[model samples]
Target: MTEQTNRPVPNPCVGVCALDENDLCIACQRSGIEIAEWGVYSDEEKREVWRKIHLREQGVLKE
Candidate 1:
């Protein structure tokens, strides 16, 4: 069996897979570039992305 390393942050993709007018994913609130680069980012980087997402959700940041 192939071994799997635990992901520090679970992927935010909810399979909505659509970008809104501002180019942020309607579901996960991540930009297309962020989604594309997610797999290559380190855990720390992923955490940072998550931070931004949470901020957006809370209206502390914009898309």
Candidate 2:
């Protein structure tokens, strides 16, 4: 296992629970599928999602 797997990744849900027209959570910026699959994702995968969320928040990623 990778070092990332040794650490537990926290869920990004902010309890907003609303999706935008693009199907991404209004608060967490995760897609509907992403939210649904979050529990099954490995730590590395979750980290990747967090990275994407950060990029989205930084305006580096539009979608």
Candidate 3:
């Protein structure tokens, strides 16, 4: 496995779990599916989710 793949990615959950109308978490901004499957996701997959969350926070991506 690559370095990134071997490294652990932190979960984005802030313990304020609530879904918006778009089904995205109001706190972490992850989709319901992403949150549900997070435990099974590879480090790379988790990183990708974090990237999207960053984009959402920056207004660079939506949904």
Over the stretch 1-63, how does candidate 2's per-residue lDDT look in tens digits? 877678799999989999999998989999999999999998778999999999988989886
Best by lDDT: 3
**Candidate 1's residue-wise lDDT over 1-63, tens digit each?**
223336467899998999999888989999889999999998778888899999988989886
TM-score of each: 0.83, 0.87, 0.87
Summed over model 2, clashes come to: 0
Worst 10 residues of 3 by lDDT: 1-10
Residue 45 error for model 1, in Å? 0.5
- By lDDT rank, best first, the candidates go 3, 2, 1
Candidate 2 all-Cα RMSD: 1.8
lDDT of the candidates, in the order given: 0.86, 0.91, 0.92
lDDT, candidate 1, residue 23?
Answer: 82
Error of 2 at 61 (Å): 1.0
- Clashing residue pairs in candidate 3, if any? none
lDDT of 2 at 48: 95
- Candidate ranking (TM-score, best to worst): 3, 2, 1
Q: Please report the TM-score between candidate 2 and the true structure.
A: 0.87
Deviation of model 3 at 39, angstroms = 0.6
Candidate closest to the true structure, highest TM-score:
3
